[model samples]
Target: MTRASLVVVNYNTASDLRACLASAREKLGDAEVVVVDNGSTDGSVEMVREEFPWAPVFFFGKKGKV
Candidate 1:
């Protein structure tokens, strides 16, 4: 069987990220969702870690998409 994955590359867009993830959870059932945070200082990392613990989050520590 084939597996689906969703990678969300974000930078200082915590609010939007929440909405996107929520929608993905509702629409994309059983899909693996990952978040790549580009060193956001707006508490995005914490929010993801706390709210979306199921999703794996990676910190790039830079201002570019990886």
Candidate 2:
């Protein structure tokens, strides 16, 4: 278990999420980054998983085909 966690809720904002995660990583080094994707077709979940593999993502709502 992590001592702290950062929870991010994303919709179709993949680019923004990525930027936010990058900034978050720079700030919170040891904190856990948790992402909750709300059925984004813009491949938000996939981008996060691929780009920021350290962050654990919790998928919700409709899953994206992309």
In terms of lDDT, the best-performing candidate is 1
- Per-residue lDDT of model 1, residues 1-66, tens digit only: 328899999999999999999998899887999999999999998999999898889998878756
Per-model C-alpha RMSD? 1.6, 3.8
In model 1, which regions exceed 4 Å deviation? none
Highest TM-score against the true fold, candidate: 1
Cα displacement (Å) at residue 27, model 2: 0.6
Q: Estimate each model's TM-score.
A: 0.90, 0.85
Give the CA lDDT, 0 to 100, for residue 10 in model 1.
90
